[model samples]
Target: RKLPGAAGAADEGAADAIRELEEQLEQATQSLRAREEESKAAEKRGQALNSKLRRAQAALAQARAEARRHAEAGAHQDQELRDQVASLSSELDRARRKLKRAGKRHEEDKADKAARKELQEDFERRGTELYKMNDKLREAVERADLLGKALAMQADEVEQLRKHVGEADEWRAKCDRLSMAEAAAAVG
Candidate 1:
């Protein structure tokens, strides 16, 4: 009934489990590293997109500046005015779309600010409540400690009273024995 290998079986099982855990940990580490690289790539892409957006905005501003220069250079040219009119029409459409997007972004920003403000207020309120609860808990613990000390003192007093009662009983027993002996002697 006693297999010698049975003792090593438990150790072998534990070793296998440790090996499997090590493999799992290695896989998790690799996965996390991959995700971190992906996150960095995404950040780069976002920065590139923002850079392109800024370049496009600068180009639009340059176009407007150029149009102003052209108008100033030729007040009497009918052809320039016609070209300017067509360009202005196209610019107006793009400007309208940009304005709409800006308005939406502004509203979203406003809502985000409100949410953040509410969250901060809630955190402060909860923190105040937590502090108050902590104070009450401390006071309760102090009261318990004081009561424990009082109880210990009372217990000591009770023990002393018990000792005194034992002594009194011993003295009474001795007196009774002496009285019985004296009465017997008198009778004799």
Candidate 2:
């Protein structure tokens, strides 16, 4: 009876050990499955990050290219502006020369106008003097004509007086002859 009871007790202990090992194995399997799901989630996140990094790199390259293009265009525009400034400066110089010439011409014209005015005044003065001289000459001619008429009248009066004197002398001679004849008759 003692031997059979000991064998039955050993058999019960062995059955309990087997049940504990199976429970431990099931827990280990569940832990392993949870770890696999976590690893797959981490791998998907890494792939998404890689895709974003590639896109960012491409955007940076395109931005650099655009900046270079803008710089080249700005340089060309600066050169064009310099050329325009030079052209404008040349035109300004030409305009200044033309203005200087015009100013000199204006001064010459003013001088000519002053000379013409002086000549006109001299001509007017000479004309006035000539008119006065002509008036004086006309008056002198009128006086000469009057003097000539008076001299002609005086000559005619002198000739008439001489003829009357000649007649008086003839009469005086005839009277003397008659007296002499009367004296001679008385004596006879």
Candidate 3:
């Protein structure tokens, strides 16, 4: 009497665990999908960033060219001012001094341009490293997707086994009850 009920409870517990595993497998699959989407989005971002970086490099080159032209114009202006100072002798030595300062500023601008070029090279190197990192991340996501599929399959197998066990337990209980009923009827 009570033995059959105890057996049924044990079977129910096993069935419940199998159900829980199935639910967990579903959640894992959803998470794997999310990771795959994130990987794709990361790839898109890297591409966009690379495109923008290329445009920025082109703009920097244009700016360097404009700066070179401006420096050349300033040098021509300095020469003209120097000739005027020579003719005017002492009236505008200050103008000649200003022209010298402008030349020094052009030297500083050359140094700045060199530094900017170095920075651009560094940025390109860093971008390449970032792309490699993203590749590894995408690979990790793919592996996780495979693992989720395997886990889902295993969970399904467990669920099927649980169902079969539950059916067998039910049939055993029914047979026991039927035999007991028949024995009691014969005794009566």
Q: Evaluated with TM-score, which candidate comes out highest?
A: 1
Q: How far is 77's C-alpha from truth in model 3 (Å)?
A: 46
User: For each candidate, what is the lDDT?
Assistant: 0.55, 0.52, 0.55
| Order of quality (TM-score) | 1, 2, 3
Error of 2 at 150 (Å): 99
| TM-scores, all models, native as reference | 0.45, 0.43, 0.40
Please report the TM-score between candidate 1 and the true structure. 0.45
Q: What's the TM for model 2?
A: 0.43
Q: Between 1 and 3, whose TM-score is larger?
A: 1
lDDT of 1 by residue, 18-67 (tens): 66655655565565556556555555555555555555555545555554
Off by over 4 Å in 1: 1-103
Deviation in Å, model 1, residue 16 alpha carbon: 99
Error of 2 at 163 (Å): 99
